[model samples]
Target: MTTAATSTTAAAAVPFRFFDVHVVRTRLLGRSMVRITFGGAGLTDFASGGRDQRFKLFLPHPGQDAPVVPTEAGEDWFPQWRALDPATRGIMRSYTVRAQRRTDGGAEVDVDFALHGADATGHTSSGPAARWAARAGAGDRAVLLGPVEPDNAGVDFRPPAGTDWVLLTGDETALPAVAGILEALPDGTDARVWIEVPHPEDIQQLDTGAQAEITWLVRDGADGPRTGLIPDAVRAARLPDGTGYAWIAGEAGTVRALRRHLVGDRGFDRKAITFTGYWRKGATEEQLVEEALSGTGPADD
Candidate 1:
């Protein structure tokens, strides 16, 4: 076995707080990805933990003008928000921080949204989060609950001390996170990445100096089940030799399948892999959260 790198360091710490931000602009990153740029006064204290850092976005429902931000006095924000009428309480969604930077005005963060088409019934129906991103414009405000300091436990990408190589696999929903992880890796770090998207145009240029070999699998109108493409591609590829760390995410079922393949068939140590179900095929994020709270969510180890 190849020896692991001995000089890797942990990410810097950051604080966690809530902020109210407004959309500065929106742009199409690819055929199925929309990049929304947000900025506001609250972002003055905003800090990001680089790789796979997640934040909660409170989006307004239709007919509501803006998201209703809860108080930060205590940890009752969730209960307080839930106490409000369902129609007016706004929806909460989780997303990865694609990029963050400080400007002359304040700070700005980019959030990439994956656009999905209509359901099996052919009715034009998308989830609330996707719908909000699709119609969001400049000046539209949303409440962001994220880190205000640099030393919190919000980030999820934790590579072990002896990790010499990396394997990253995911679908469109995990693209931003995967990109962030790749960019955070040191130069000369060996990594193999596999990302599955709905369209060939979804492949965007990644800015990273790491020694990475990326394979983008475009599932354009595949006849059979679509979820298997990512795992199939991962199963076919040959992994590099080393004490490797693998990060996998995307649809819940596929994530589990890929984890089994890595641990069972490929002989990767279960402790060496970090997997998360970003979303389930038919279930909503709300349901997934409920499952997690009940201690039944997909395992990350």
Candidate 2:
């Protein structure tokens, strides 16, 4: 029962530790996303669980040199963080590991952030994380609560044995996870994927060995409206012939709707589908974290 799928579903805390990482470089991955490469001597021990690996990122306050995380508290860091002054405490957010590399210089991890700034209509909707990432530079410091083991609880994209094919759905928020999953898939595996982005330029070349049919849906397309683009696209398609496992993540509402469609209309086995609402519309990360800590909201959707 100690399979990769079971590892994430288990309630046991993941084997994670805190690391003081710094931005080594940044690259504009697309119009609405940026990839920040983090490196440090501490990263030598920072293991990435690969596909869809989730981790907590702590960014510094405006005037701080590095994020103020009580890493010395060890397993009790969360409670310590809660007790700190919110004004000076590090801003916390969750992100997926796009890739991990061990170059001659040192070990590095790439995290892709989705920029949600206002469109051409002159509005301000970007969150603290997005704003910070937009201006992040080389040598910027942050704290990371990342895995120390390769088979930790953070990696969630696990399809059971004998899975004939797989279905993946994600919006811009889940793009990093989806890309990681696609790259980790076994060669010749059948994968049906749908990705929604803010603009056509947001799409990128993804490397995968699986027989994946990836459809990119742009929200700003002049041809049509954007509501339910992924769901509608999947519904209209002819799925591969076999039992399927689905891993979905994106906007909360859309994720739920697509899950219902798959279970009710497509008749997929409920247990075979792993869904995560990476974020919700109009909800701040602080609010979600508060709810999660107080046990008042849904856990990992």
Candidate 2 global CA lDDT score: 0.82
What does candidate 1 score on TM? Answer: 0.89
lDDT string for model 2 (1-301, tens) is: 0011111352245579998889999998778898999998878898887889888899987789998899999788989998999888898888999998887767899999987762334334676677778888899999999988888878788887779999999988899999999999999999999999988889989999999999999898544223689988988999988899999888767777888888998988878888877766656766666766676665333
What are the lDDT figures for the candidates, one per model?
A: 0.77, 0.82
User: Candidate 2: where are CA atoms >4 Å away?
Assistant: 1-12, 118-124, 221-226, 298-301
Cα lDDT, model 2, residue 8: 30
lDDT of 1 by residue, 69-114 (tens): 5756457787788777766786877888899998888889999888
Which window of 10 residues has the lowest lDDT sum in candidate 2? 1-10
Q: Indicate the worst ten consecutive residues by lDDT in candidate 1.
A: 1-10
Tell me the alpha-carbon RMSD of every candidate. Answer: 5.6, 4.3
lDDT of 2 at 151: 83
**Model 1 misses residue 236 by how many Å?**
1.5
